[model samples]
Target: MGIPRALLVLCIATAFLSLGPRGSLGRSHLHKRQQSHGRRGNGGHRLQSPVDSPADPPAAGTSTTVTPSNSSSDSSVFDVRSFGAVGDGVTDDTEAFRSAWRAACSVESATLSVPSDGVFMITSTIFPGPCQPGLVFQVDGVVMPPDGPQCWPKSDSKHQWLVFYQLEGMTLRGEGTIEGNGEDWWSLPCKPHRGPHGSTLPGSCDSPVLIRFFMSCNLTVRDLRIENSPQFHIKFDACEDVHIEGLSINSPAFSPNTDGVHIENTRSVTIYNSMISNGDDCISIGPGCSDVDIQNVTCGPGHGISIGSLGMHNSEACVSNVSVKNAVIRNSDNGVRIKTWQGGMGSVSDISFDTVYMENVRNCIIIDQYYCSNKGYCQNQSSAVYVSGVTYANIKGTYDVRSPPMHFACSDTLPCTNITMSEVELLPHEGELVDDPFCWNAYGVMRTVTIPPIPCLQDGQPESLQEIPNLGC
Candidate 1:
């Protein structure tokens, strides 16, 4: 037997969701419900609106200049307009942008500039590079896709747009916007079914991710505004030494699969001082990612940060040395989470979530090993991913009254071990009483008394690992 075909195929298209986006009741209803349950005494604050900071990226079409750093010996600049790019949003700028990239990348320490007068309409394109040292790709105007899904070229793969491939020593920064113009794509009959009463047709989903960096290293992307992506907003795959900061990502809360930032097969990464609100995860850490540091992030109106749905379909996965601190997650589905599928083998270790504050969050801490999607059929499997050395410390929050504050549903065959939690306190946003935590096949110690307490956790791993008959992966 091999990995399940359902999991293997769906893993790429829908990584974080088993079901579609929940029908939003609006935050006002939740606030009133919480107030009715004596939530005023629970110390949970009201939900916050999207934040606008002074350091945020400038509006589109703002006048800005792209310049090389003082350390650069070569200060050549390549303007896209000089390469025959019409700044009007109607003309095709894909070839022009590519031409500019080639010229700037050929010269050492150069800057590729997008003028700030108008929108630059571009098709799905790749900017491949072994670019000159200290290269900068600066955007100072709006860059957008075609009008809608109807205008999309059938020849292009609907899986990706705006690819930055195989680049080194690059900085992509500016006060401009990369808009996906994805309103029509989200209304596809097979995509989450936003029709009458959420009805849908049975067909394939072919939504594209907005921006991606593949096989690149030593990159910096900062001070950019990204919006209305068809899928994951920004993805970094097989890249190293990536630094991202001062970004704002926004989308409707019902846009499916719009993870704010996703990293896979990447190392030595840092994401800080950002705001993300989408229909899916704010930050999703995938397989082969380690030495990651995330701090000073604000997330809401979506799924909070997550690690994995890793090792799906019996694939090998090993993730370690991740830390998240000084974060706020409010009015979201789940806070910090780790989810994996059954019958997969590998390990996730050395992770910590610290100093996280939550408001009206559902399932603030979770690890679900039997994660399945689309109500897919999954048979019992004996092999499991080993989850160990995870810690949740200084976590204080008010949770939605409907579900328990924490849930750990580990594999029965290979249970999660060495979990540690301390200074944890959770109360209902609407109720005076806190819900009890749910645990199964997980071993951990709590350094302090948690609200409602966790008594379902057993002392150690089960003594059996023998496989039963007819278990499929």
Candidate 2:
């Protein structure tokens, strides 16, 4: 017998409910449920689940999912554009960037992508983090600051811009640009581009560093372009285990204090395969640095790689185990230098500069122990930072005719010792006469024949070491 209509309808409804939704309909129902629960998308205006959930970990090499702001439903990448960011280069995207960083940094093994094809204008912002492991900050667009110093807010931090503070296991890598727009800052009356006959200004004259990482560790910054900073382009302070490669740093040759990369109190750093051209030192290694390796660098239109200017203001410094090899420095002020001020105590040892080629450089190889650049008078003191075990080998260069090719102006009381030079040659570029290498209170041995002659360096350790405490070769 045929079932009654009501009974048949009831049976079909029961079967459908027992079996649940299938295929496309099931997926659609789940999507709607996630939407109702306020899940956000990961990338490109798509929907995604909340990052705080105990979701399944991503597969090997797969990007971890993050729920971006605005709850865009569809993808698993956290795109900054979805979070109320107008990339028109005018609107302030600072808030959006901070929000994105917050959301992205919350999840373990996530990526925060900055989309391309537009310029993102951000004011001075700090991305502070003790974020999860494997966090990737991928930038594929132009991240520019305000027009110049005139547009900067008075209350903003004058010491730093774009700071990544206290972050670990972070990677900042991409094919993008970070523009400082520092024309106005450079033109200030106190800067090198001093206004109106280089007159000094009385007001606060401090400028911000473009990118700084302070008290952070295990960081990797690669494949990026940083340009036109008001002060130092990239600075790492009190950080450790950093790797910086494939970078391009550009600024005006006359812009003051625009050091390409300045590191202080940092260790285990490797800076390789980079190009740096700025007003100040291409790579400035400050005190408390060790185990640093810099190679395959192209530096010009700036001061060459430098160690110290340490022991300044009567402070002690200890630096060791630095190696710079396979570098080309052209039209620079100094090729390889180790400078320390008087009235301080410490040691700089186990340093080597090898296979360096210089062109038209002034003071190709120098060791200035009495480094006094300030206007104040510095009294002669027996205390000094001891310089020893420094080897300069395979250094071939053409120096400017104005200054001596090699200068070693060691301390009078605490003379530098154990300095070695091998296969070094420096010829004058402009004139026929080559200036002599001046040596004062420096004791070392020459390994081979040197151009322009370095016969001034004495043999064996200096007798002054017996008088100074904790001093040796």
Candidate 3:
């Protein structure tokens, strides 16, 4: 006889519980509700607006509160030490957190508070639900990983270390750090390397992301510094109502696949007042995400903010309702980019980039449908995705190289359309702009750019000295 799917899932959950701290036997209770019918796979069903749900509102004159310092002002603040957790940074504090979270499950205004100047080593996942309103994971100190690889769970899953899944109305606040001692994990031996960088040699390295959130709602993470990640710094998947502010992510500039932040399959997310410096894209917005706003961000020595490289496998993947404004990028690969894979299906629309400052940029603006390939050598002849309804305004930047200040390469199949640009001026690096200042496939059109004289087309000019146009301005 074979075990049922739900039973199999339960067994996995139980196994995880056994690895938890002593006396912190957090049990998993399964309750089937009609709402479960709407959920899909890991890529769950898209969520409708909260107004469309039939849920009742909170009672009038009732509000939740959290008190971090044990003031007499709130009844909801709970010390994590009560659950046997020590925030000494050296102690294994995973179990204490589990107990605190479990106890908060029944409270309307519960908080799992962490005292200042201690390190809490986390080895397990922290799951918070809607009932735990005003739930705060206040980290005034560092939340560090266990010392060695042996202390971490030996698993093949992507989230082998620590992860947060399917929580609501939760906030992670602190003037602290989430540190991943990634030298061991990322330097592990793996095959068919899966990162922005190409395949690695045997016994080389495999980068794993530090933090990941899946299918969560109403989440806020503020005033935190995440450092030394193996792969992507942070990833949010299929989450809604997410806000991240005043966060700093720092990693080695040469770290492979260390994307600063990635938001995929989500909605209503805002990332603001953040500083990110990594090897890969500072921010990457994947498919099925919408209503994203990024502001007051400073990125450098990394790939700039991008939309797509989408339509990888499926026929439809939509990325819409995005705005990138009031940001600064310096010494980066490209300032603004939109890329899509060939032979996939989807559309990118309603996107806007405004008030961006770039300095010493290799390419001030670029839309490369032909991405992730050797220079000028793309695999597929046509692109699988569609890009349209994009606007770039008030872009002030400097180009470091003679490469084009702006380059747009749309797919021959689904050419880019409905694009507009205004007040986008690219100062010369050493010479003038390309005379034609435009290149387009048969299906697309290049409009709105003021052409300039093409320089370095002949004579002793190096191939790198050729000028590309700043079209659409």
Q: Model 3, 136: alpha-carbon shift in Å?
A: 1.4
Clashing pairs in 3: 88-119, 89-119, 309-339, 342-384, 343-384, 344-384, 435-454, 449-472
Q: Name model 2 segments beyond 4 Å from true.
A: 1-76, 193-201, 375-379, 471-473
What digit string (tens of lDDT, one per residue) describes model 1 on residues 152-206? 7778778998899999999987777777777777777787655556555766678
Full-model lDDT for every candidate: 0.79, 0.80, 0.66
Rank candidates by TM-score, best first.
2, 1, 3
Error of 3 at 451 (Å): 8.3
Predicted structure 3, TM vs. truth:
0.73
Whose TM-score is greatest here?
A: 2
| Candidate 3, residue 469: how far the Cα is off, in Å | 29
- Per-residue lDDT of 33-67 in model 3, one digit per residue for the tens? 12111112222112222222212221323222222
Give candidate 1 regions above 4 Å deviation. Answer: 1-75, 193-200, 460-473
75: Cα error in model 3, Å:
4.8
Per residue, candidate 2 scores C-alpha lDDT tens digits across 109-180 of: 776677655567777899988887878887776777766666676678887889998899998877767777
TM-scores, one per candidate: 0.81, 0.83, 0.73
